[model samples]
Target: MLKPEIKVLDVQGQYRIHTEFYRSDTAENTIILVNGSMATTASFAQTVKNLHPHLNVVLYDQPYAGKSKPHNQHQKMLTKELEAQMLLELIEHFSANYLMSFSWGGTAALTALACTPRRIEKAVISSFSPLINGPMRDYLERGRRCLADCNRTQVGNLVNDTLGKHLPSLFKRFNFKHVSSLAEHEYAQMHFHIEQVLTCDQPCLLDTASGIEIPVLFINGAWDEYTSASDAQHFVQSIENSQFVRLENTGHFLDMEHKSASHISKAAMLGFLQPAHAEHLAASR
Candidate 1:
C-alpha cells in the first residue's frame, strides 16, 4: 500500500484545503481526482490506490467538505466560479497534467476548462451536465428542504427515490442507510452545496462549455435523470475534441457502482488517461 503525503493548502489566505498526494516515481503524469459535493479526500481512497501506480494521483477536500475549512463559516456557499479558480491554483501548484471529475466536480472542471483550456492535457468527467433540467432542480430543492428540516429519513427517501433506485441492488440499502445517517457537518455541507447549485446560473455555465479546447471524455449513466445521458451528450457537442460514453444500467454514482460496473467505469477512464490515447486524441484535433 502506498501512503499518501498529506498537506493543507492556504489558497490566497481564503480557504484551508486539505489534500492528499500519491506520488509514483515511475509515472510521467499527475491526475487530480476532484470529489463530488460534500465528498472528502477519503472518498477517493480506492480510486487513488487504483490510479497511483499508473499515474500520480492527488485528492482534496473542497471547502466545507471533510477537513477543508470554509472561507467563512457564516457563509457556507462558494460559487462554482470561485471553485474553478481554486482548482486552477491546485493544478498550477502541483503541476498536474490531467483531471478526473465526478458529479458536482464536473461543474468546477468545466468552468476551469472554459476559462483556461490549455492548463490540462486531458480530462474525464462523469455524471455531470451544465444544464440543470426540471427534475434535477426539483431534486436539489427537495434535498435542501429535507436537510433544512433535519429530516434524515426524508433525505434518505429522496435519494433512494431518485439516484438510489438506479444503483445496483447490492448498494441500494447501504446507500439509503449511509445517506440517512450523515454526520451533522455532512448534512450542513450538503444543504449549502445544494443551495449553491440551485442558485447558480445554468445557462451561463452551459455557454462556457463552447470555450473548451483540450481533449475531454464525458461518461454518463444511462439512467441518471439528474445529469442525464442526453444532457451530457448535448453538452459534449460544444467541445471540439470530446467524446461521450454512456454506461448501461449505471446511474449517477459511477464510482459507487457494484464491482463489475465499477471496474468498467474505471477501465474506461484508465484507457482515456493512457499516454498513447491522449496523444492520438490531440493529433486527431
Candidate 2:
C-alpha cells in the first residue's frame, strides 16, 4: 500500500524520483508530501495510508534521501530548491494538485508551488519555522557540527542535549535510533553530506514563507524543541490565510513517532485540504 513509485523521466535530463500514491485509482489531484533534511519518503507512508482513500497522497525522496540516485554535479550542492523545481516538473509530469512540507523541505515545496503558482490547491507545513530566521541559522550551525564531528557518541550526546528542552514526557518518546543512523551515513556521501548543511541558506526559508500566498496550514508539536511554536506562530501571523495546529504530547517528528498525535494533526490537515476530503461527510468527508 505504501512504497516509492519511482519513475525516471527525461524532462530535459534523466530524473529518478519517488512518489507514493495512496489511491492510484483516483484521478484526484495529489497532495505532495515533502520530507525534512536527511529524511526519506518512507516517513509519510503510515499517514498517507490512513488518509481517506479517495485522494491521491504522495511523498517523495529528494535527490539524496531515498531510492533516487544522487548526482554530484546535478545537486547544486545541498540545495533542494531545484529538488522542488524537479517536484514541479513531476507535478506537471503527473498532474498533482496540493502539497505538504516539513522542516527544510518547506522551502523546496514552496518553490514548487510558487513556480507553478496556481497549481497547488493547499499546502501544510509542520515543525517548520521558515519565516523566522535565527533559530534555523542556529540549528544549521549545529548541523554543520554534526557532520564535522562524526564522533557518534559525542555527536549523539550533543544532539540529545539540544533536544533536552522539550518536555520530558514527549522527550522520552524521541527516536534516537531513527536519527542515530545519521552517524552511519557514508562519509564519502555527496556534499560529504556537508554542502547543503553549510551552503544552503536559511533566509531561503524565510523568503519562501513570506513569498507564497497559498492556503497554508502549519503543524507543530507543543513540546517540539526542534522548531519552536513561537516561530510557527510568527509565520501564521505573517502568511495570509494560514492556520496553525499544535499537537499535544509529541516532539519534532509528529508524523513518525507519535501515532495519535499525527492522527490529530492529520484531521486538521484534512480540513485544510478540504475540497477533496470534503466529498464524503463528517468521517474525513
Candidate 3:
C-alpha cells in the first residue's frame, strides 16, 4: 500500500484545507477525489488504495469536515461558490489532470469545471444531480432539524435509516455505531453541510453545468433515491461530452454499498479513468 503525504493548504487565506496526496511514480495523471457532504478524506481511503498504483490521487477534507475546520468558526456554513474556489486552488497547486467526485462534491466539481474547463482533462462524478428530489430534500430537512435540536442520536438514526439501511448487516451496525460516536462539532458541521445543500441554487448550478465541455463520466445508482437515475441522466445531458452509468442495486453511497454493487461501481470508475481511455477521449475532443 502506498502511503499518502499529508499537508494543509491555505486557500487564498480564506480557509485551510487538509489534503492527502498519493503520488504514483509511474503514472502520468493525477486525479482529485472530492468528498461528498459529511464525508472526510478518510471516506476515500479505499478509493485511494485502488487508484494510487495507477494514478496519482489527491483527497481532502472540505470545510467543516474532518481536520479542515472553517476559518471563521462562527460562519460554519459553506456555499457552492466557496467550495468551487477551493477546488480551483487545489487544481492549480497539483496540476491535476482528472477529477472524481461524489454526491455534493460533484456540485463544486461541476462549478469549477464550468469556470475553467481547460484546466482538467476529464472528470468522473458519481451520485450527483443539480435538481434535488423530494425525498432527498425531506431527508436533508430531517437531518437539519435534528441538528438544530442538537439531537445527535437521532441524527445518527436518520443516517442509519436512510443510507445505512442499504449496507450489509454487519456493516450496517458498524455504520450506526460510527455515526453515533461522532463528536458534537462534527454534528454541527454536518448540519451546516445539509443546510448548504437544502439552500443551494439549483437552476444557477444547472446553468453552470451546461457550459462544461470536458469529457465526463457521470455515475449514479439505480436504487439511489437521493439522486435518482433519471435526474442524473438529465444533468448529464447538459454536458456536451458526457456518459451516464447506472449501477443496479446501489444507493447514494456507492463505495459503501453491498459487495456486488460496490465492485461494479469501483470497476466502472477505474476503467473510465485509465490513461488509455482518457487519452482516447481527449483525442476525440
Tens-place lDDT per residue, model 2, 1-285, is 544455545442655565555555654557767876656765566667655464677666655456554531343344456566677776676566777887667767766665645677678887876543465456556656665666555444544555433424444334344445552343224224445545656565555566567788888888776676767777654477788888888667675555677667767777678744554546644
What are the lDDT figures for the candidates, one per model? Answer: 0.79, 0.61, 0.79
Clash count per candidate? 0, 2, 0
C-alpha RMSD between model 1 and the true structure: 4.2
Window of ten residues with lowest summed lDDT in model 3: 69-78
Error at 92, model 2, angstroms: 1.2
lDDT per residue (tens digit) for residues 1-72 in model 1: 888899888874678788888998978889998888756776676677667677999888876666775533
Tens-digit lDDT track of model 3 for 1-285: 667898888885767888889988888889998887767787776677667667889898875767776533536556677888889999989989899998878888998898864569889999887777898888888988887777867877888788556767766676667667766676776777677667777776678788788889989888788887788877655788888888998888776776687667767876787857545544776
Which candidate number has the best TM-score? 3
Which ten-residue region of model 2 has the weakest summed lDDT?
183-192
lDDT of 1 at 145: 89
> Candidate 2: which stretches are off by over 4 Å?
2-6, 10-14, 24-27, 70-76, 131-139, 152-204, 236-238, 275-285
